[model samples]
Target: MELRIGCRRPPEESVPGLLRYRIASKIVKRQPLGGTDDEWVVIEPVYRAIELLEQLHDTPAQEALLIGRFSFNVRFKWFKNWANSEASRRLGLASIPDGPANLRMLRRTLSLEMAYRPGGVLATKIYMKHIAVATTEGCASRPGGAQAELLAEVNQHESERDLHLVLEEFRNYQEGVLPAGPGARSLTEFFAGIDAQLDAASAAAPKTQRNDRDVLNLLTKRAKVLHLGPANYCWFTGPSRALCLKLAGTPTVDRPLIGMCGSARCPQATHHSGHRSVWAEHADRTKIFLGQLGTTRKTERTRLQADHDRALRVIAGIDSAIAIEG
Candidate 1:
């Protein structure tokens, strides 16, 4: 059941012929074919294989066995299921009826060693050499077909998810869940204004259908100009240049980094009626703390006062913005 990497000999108590062997020259070499003699190279594809393995499965390696070797153990059946699931996910295929058998064929095609002890519920020891050979063969054989299909499917899924989220945000604005901003009165008016902006942007862009990249670009432009602030459901508020850049391209709804939030100056931040109570409470608490500070603690009191002033300014700004719209 234990998977180990490297050429170190196992304990004598272990079953005979269980250790798969490869020549040291095959593991590493100075030069071969047209290569220069001064250049040393690792003949074994361990790092590349491990990269592929990590991408396919989330299993953590248990421990280092020896030089250039690591070990981890899994139940034989679990390993089979894991391989099958990994293949299915990567290939974007429905679960095949003969997953284990297909995997065995794949291993055979790639000339990977699958040495196991003779038992009903045996544990197989798979090595880096076997994994490397199999992964290389799989990649070489498929080249573009399965991998391309997977990439396309992934892109489609992400695009759909992002589109849904943007629509949901628009819906929230329409439902009064989000605050009204400048040049918009009721939810209906806001929606109309947004539609008009989108129309204008789309007209300015090269002709494209709704789902085309050009249209998406138009939508992104409108979204940026709208400067619709964070919804009530937002978990964090901050200066969001990174978030803005990401959304300008992909339109995801990822949470902001709380510790990095520069709320006062954040372009993505908007204070609404719903957030007034929170600001009020915070300001009140900060004021109380400021009042309790003695003259000797001048530095501490100054810092608290600065925070209080910032909070009050933010509150005033929000009220002012809302009043202009009203």
Candidate 2:
């Protein structure tokens, strides 16, 4: 920080670089002391205040040289009083927040800002799964993720770009192209109901604004509510709560860790034909791996077999849904 004085001084002090004291990055100016002719001596008090804020969060006895003779409570109280002074109030700056704990809130905000950047999802994937870093987990397992709620608000907006794609898929689904996951069965009904509701709403009100695009807005709300994944749909309107291992023992109802979803067995999970190719590949890979496994690896074999079976079941469900639609 460079503290400047309005009063005239030596010619060398004209340049800020020539100043004897330089610490943090801010601009401070000296002014009158308590409406008197005496100078307030802004440099020392403000510098110490900034230092106390910087190093005092984790410990009080930090930077003895910078924060000389300043106790933990007295420094903060002095700063707060100085901030409320008539001259300080004239600056119209927001008061400095309580350090560390309040500043940690920034980490949570940074998580949001970072997650929405150009490659935020891929970049922040590890951070989201981390126990400490805040993120909205679909596989996420955040017990009470405010981050998840923020993402929902974000997705509600950006998902608009893909609404037409969802409509196109719904309109021209394949003969056996079913949604994937256990919730697959309800997808067709939900779409149909949405259309019917729009039609009825338009008829009942006559002037009510409604279109396929507008009708599909409900999907955005549903997506937010169910924590829908981009690659999969959630037809979770029935008895099955969730089969995510993350939610197994937790008491609080939070975002389902969609990454850990029991896709085939979970009652709420559903995949559409869009996801069929991936499921097919997964099943095929597991089948090939099963062949590669020896008899001694029973556990591995059993796990692979279970995965294979789940994939097949999910594929079958998709086909069944599409066939029913036909």
- CA displacement after TM-score superposition, residue 208 of candidate 1 (Å): 19
Give the per-residue lDDT of model 2 (tens digit) for 1-326: 12222221223354776543334222222434322232222244555565455454444443323323345456557877778677787999557655543334655665567556655543455543344433343333333344556568777676664565556655644343446555655665666676677778889999878656675676665544454554465444433376664457543445566666666666676677677788888889999999999989999999999889978887786666666654
- How many residue pairs clash in each candidate at the backbone level? 2, 10
**Candidate 2 Cα misplacement greater than 4 A, ranges:** 1-180, 199-210, 217-220, 226-231, 235-240, 245-247, 323-325
Please give, for residues 7-35, the per-residue lDDT of candidate 1 as tens digits.
22222323765433232223222446533
TM-score, one value per model: 0.31, 0.46
lDDT of 2 at 293: 96
For lDDT, the strongest prediction is 2
* Candidate 2's TM-score: 0.46
Screening candidate 1 with a backbone cut-off below 3 angstroms (N, C-alpha, C), the clashing residue pairs are: 238-261, 239-262
How good is model 1 by TM-score?
0.31
Give the Å error, residue 229, model 2.
4.5
| lDDT at position 324, candidate 2 | 66
Cα lDDT computed for each candidate against the true fold: 0.46, 0.57
